[model samples]
Target: MDSGIITILLPLALAIIMVGLGLELTPRDFSRVGKHPKAVLIALFCQLVLLVGIAFVICKVLALPPLLAVGLMLLAASPGGSTANLFSYLFKGDIALNISLTAINSVIAAFTLPLIVNFSIQYFMNDGQQISLQFSKILQVFSIIIVPVCMGMLIRHFAPHLTEKLNKPLRIFAVLFLILIIVGAIIKESHQIMSYITQVGLATVIFCICSLMIGYFVPRLLGINSAQARACAFEIGIHNSTLAMTIALTVMANSAVAMPAAIYSIFMYVFAAIFGTLLNRFSRDDVSSRTTSPT
Candidate 1:
């Protein structure tokens, strides 16, 4: 794709993806959080606080370039996605909980994504980089994320049939667009692509594994059930990389800042699948042992 086409398609594709997300959500998804406040709260803490902190530490420890560091932070800020629910279902997690977390996280990310990305820009890109989200630009970023979501919600509310028809195609488009964006970003920085991957590849893989671990163990340690922990694991682990990439490419207008998310996207699905499989095996073992015991 040409740079001009990518520039136009990036935001447009993101809006379609957000609309697909909204179509999956309803008022009940948000309200469901009240039914499992502890799980919800713990998951959010892991996502918004713990995961972001972990990414920052990885960036600093790995000594990532400024744009890549900002990309990592942006990826950290992106919410969970429908893929989390799918992984949760396959791994015997509480799918309802995954859906609820994804819904609430999407809403929360509209505000937090801008803040985290801006902070990263200030901290990492301050030397001479011309990229920064001013106050007005912050609002623009928020609008780009939140407005389409709200519009989709309204469509789902008022025109459920149409939403149902559009949902699957939009989801397919979302996945395709994500791949194209990642490729575009990589190609844009092809001269430095190898270096970016060298600096970011291990950090992204480690961050993904850590995310799944923290999402599961943190909630489990707090006495949440294993099923719920599995849900949290995928929810916290499988971030909306498409959203992060869109913001980096479209909102920030910086392909360099999109690199981390692009790289992380490549690793996250593979890692999450492995993590979910391990969790499933453990769950089966626990069940088998219990069933065999004289209980």
Candidate 2:
């Protein structure tokens, strides 16, 4: 596929996803974070903190190239994405909370992602040359994730009967198609993907694990329950890699920078499934103990 085609494909798919997100949400969903500041703050802090910490370690200790490191940081900075709502629903998490967190986080990321990315480029880009940060790029990202999302929500708000009818199949299609995009990306880059898999692969796996851990414990350490912990784990830890890849291929125009998200895109679903299953098992144990203990 042409780089331009690859560029166009992901963003178009993401716009569809965002529109669905908005259709399912209301303005109240966007504001729910304020209603529960703890969950909101926990999700936001984990995302920002982990991006900086891991990007720093990857850049400084591992001495990875700047674009790759910045790519990883961008992955961290991106929000939970449309898929998380599915994951949250399947895992019996607070869907309302998940939707709210994703909405607020995606908006905040519009500003924060560029700042973190440019700083990482400054420190790690190897040649010490400035990384590009154009206003047009920011607008494109906003269009890709936010604008369509709001449009969807508007449709839902005005024509909720239709939205209610369409919501389920649209969500299903979005999930399945996004999976295909991930597969296509890997298949298209089969040879190079295999070659880069080991180096980028290991880091991607570690990042997912670390992200899950932080999303869960960081909240619980502050006293969030297991259910909310499960919610936070997926929401904070799972990033919108499609958006990250959009940035890399479109804005950054470097496949190496796109590699982290490609690698992560593969790993996150596997680990998220494993993590959700494990959390479910633990939750069952808690239920059993509580029933026996009369709480």
Candidate 3:
């Protein structure tokens, strides 16, 4: 909540988290996108374009307050993270596809996120607040995201033994840091927490559901297999709340702008689990139907 924390510790924390993300990644992750072109392209479209559009529609339809609207847009712009891969593994999704999507999305988001957030700020908050993501700030966003990731990749490339040893610990640390940021955001807006949730809860919930459905069904409609469809569902559904919140608190210097992400963080896992379970149920039924068919 303090300026010191926002300016100093927030970037440091985000850098550590991004580095942890990188430690799990390698060039193979990026190159794998080429192997699953349909799945990857569909997932990216859902993430970078469709999701942002959905958020904008929700913001307009719900008539969200300026700061909160911008926050929702920020959340929409954030890409999936490691947690998506975990969900994919648990729910019969294509974990490899999830990883490739995440790896590529993270790189693309370093550019797209700034564009979306700046547009949100100008459109949503222009009447009163004057927030601008100028070239310098965009460069800062790029550095904050890409630099640490590159550093971590280099570390893993040069020191395989050390990278292996530190991988789990770094992930643990990143999760802990996310929890702290969410809690801090809640505390900073303690009195307004309930009201904020009341304002944004339904919008986020609908957005999450739509995200999962779009991620899954769109790919399936395009003839992507079930496993890859599942991967797309989770990849598009579970956003990197930590990245969104970090950019809000540090880059935008507004905790109000972090509210949607913090609240969405609480709800996304629950929603994703339910969605995954339902998908598995239908998948089992489909398999049984096929197995029971006449030979």
Predictions: Cα RMSD each: 1.5, 2.5, 1.3
lDDT of 2 at 190: 75
User: What RMSD does model 3 have?
Assistant: 1.3
Q: What digit string (tens of lDDT, one per residue) describes model 2 on residues 137-167?
A: 7777667777988889889978989898878
Q: Judging by lDDT, tell me the better candidate of 2 and 3.
A: 3
- lDDT for 89 (candidate 2): 80
The 0-to-1 C-alpha lDDT of every candidate, in the order given, reads 0.86, 0.76, 0.90
**Structural similarity to truth (TM-score) of each candidate:** 0.95, 0.89, 0.96
Please give the lDDT score at residue 245 for candidate 1: 79
Ranking the candidates on TM-score from highest down gives 3, 1, 2
Tell me how far candidate 1 lies from the true structure as C-alpha RMSD in angstroms. 1.5
Query: Which segments of candidate 1 are over 4 A away from where they belong?
Result: 1-3
Q: On residues 40-63, what C-alpha lDDT tens digit does candidate 3 reach at each position?
A: 988898888888999999999999
Give the poorly placed runs of model 2, Cα more than 4 Å off: 127-131, 289-295
Which candidate leads in TM-score? 3
